[model samples]
Target: MIGVVSNSRHASDYSQGVRAMADFARKCLDNWVLTVNGSFEQHQKMIRATLAKRAYELFELRGREHGLHLEDWVIAEQELVHHNLNGNSSGFCILVDCPRDPGIITILSVTSRSLLVFQSRAMADHNPELIAVHLLPENIHPEQTAVDAVDGVLQVHLPKQRNKRRK
Candidate 1:
């Protein structure tokens, strides 16, 4: 009778462990779906704004020479799209080793005029490799922001600029 009781107890414990693991797995899946959906929406918005900003920069780069506005805009859009697809920006890529678990790899916090990237620790720990590219607004200076690698993920804080009204 004692042996049967011991076996029964062991079985109960094993079943409980399995149920707990299943619940955890389900939670992780839900979180992953939400993160991916959010990232896609944010990326769409950023791409539009970034393309316009880059086009303007290109126009300025050519000494403000006239008649190439359309060309500049097209080129800027193409370049930005290509860079994002390839995950390689000329000089704006940050690489870090992250964990395989996914919770929130890239978190974009956007206000009226600024954007911020916040990364979670779990997302940084098991991936073993991570690449992050940050695009800043035209008016904000890069020198004004700060980049820190905490808990294996890169965190960038971009302060927003207030536009002064002209009288």
Candidate 2:
């Protein structure tokens, strides 16, 4: 995470810490550098470690402001897909990710309830690879697996659904 860097120890410099960290993370993603060879498994392992490191780096960079941990925030993959709630042919693309594979970023179909919903770690905890709510009409329950990315740390499985709603 690289953003606004401070030259001296001033109180205001401390305040821009968030922006600085955001810049840093963006740069890391944009200019991510990795070198490895061998089996696909080996390559994925390296990517997984890299993703985890970036997540922790983000947490550390922002520690000066919110005092948060790596797990405290939601680490959604940057990809987005279109979502349809009203059964419209065309859908709106929103930034969201499956809890299971946070790295294989994609959009989702959320009802009005989750329209503007941004997830926290509490929400993504063990979320299934939400490959579109619009499942195939005749598909059976398939097995779980890690995301196909540089990192393979994507958690698989949806959160347990409860009959009770949040109060």
Candidate 3:
């Protein structure tokens, strides 16, 4: 994946590393999921693998009901060993296996985090009398949002698809 940034005064190598991590995430999600404990390096690794896996899979699971083989995707994991205060040096690091939405992904493997997210989304989406967009969770900043303190299949509505009901 390509890296996007608008700051030259930031850690350029680190930003590049972030993209590299995203690329890795796009490739080896499962492994990254298993790793990535909480350390910055671990988080970067998981991010890369998650990005790699999701972008690669696009969440399609039709062929595997009867048992289809999954592909071993590999992202070009380049090293970012530079750190400059004024450059914002950036790159990708990867753990490969862990994901925020493991339930949908766990069709290929079984993981607790993925399962929880998948189930949470599925329930929110399936619940009727509720707007669809609200069903999908959002990454609120500062640990806050309009739906603060909401739980049990949250009903969030996206502005673009108002009144639309998701499956």
Candidate 4:
């Protein structure tokens, strides 16, 4: 993950913001070791907690209105998930569950508005490769983005681009 950030405008230029995942793999294979405790269940729990807090806030905002609990929860989920996907200026985090093993290689590409994951070695015999592409909500600061893989999960921190204020 130690490489010069490129300034290329090409869509394939994954090196512009985040260091290529290939570099991470190479370093890990050589000597770099990352020890982190994370899992898909943990990610789900956090999401639920966030949703609950947001729903409660919405309830309070509505003057503590009754009989709209389900509605509030739904609205909160929509807002948070949409905001996370659409790109809020405050940024967001995404968690991906992936197996961590020497035999598997995961190639990832990230840009200002999207994330692409391609697993070279499929975990199952029926599938030769696994590919996933996610569209971001809005433009992001690729350089400020961070990604971590721990305990069969990947956590990507996407920082939204700051608006330049004119004086």
Q: Which candidate achieves the best lDDT against the true structure?
A: 4
Ranking by lDDT, best first? 4, 1, 2, 3
Better of 2 and 4 by lDDT: 4
Candidate 1 lDDT by residue in tens digits, 104-125: 4433333322333333443333
- The ten-residue window of minimal lDDT in model 2 covers 29-38
Off by over 4 Å in 3: 1-38, 59-149, 153-167
Per-residue C-alpha lDDT of model 4 across residues 69-105, encoded as one tens digit per residue: 9999998777644333533459967775565555555
lDDT of 2 by residue, 1-167 (tens): 11122223343322222112222121112111111111233223323443444566566677645645444333512221124322222222222233453333232112212221112232333221222222111211121111222332222221212244789
TM-score of each: 0.30, 0.21, 0.19, 0.44
Name the lDDT of candidate 3. Answer: 0.23
Cα RMSD for predicted model 3:
19.7
The candidate scoring highest on TM-score is 4
Error of 1 at 38 (Å): 3.7
Residue pair clashes in candidate 1: 98-124, 98-125, 98-126, 98-127, 99-124, 99-125, 99-126, 99-127, 100-126, 100-127
Per-candidate clash tally: 10, 12, 58, 5
Q: Estimate the Cα RMSD of every predicted model relative to the unseen true structure.
A: 21.4, 18.5, 19.7, 14.2
For model 3, what is the alpha-carbon lDDT of residue 111? 17
Better of 3 and 4 by lDDT: 4
Cα RMSD, model 1: 21.4
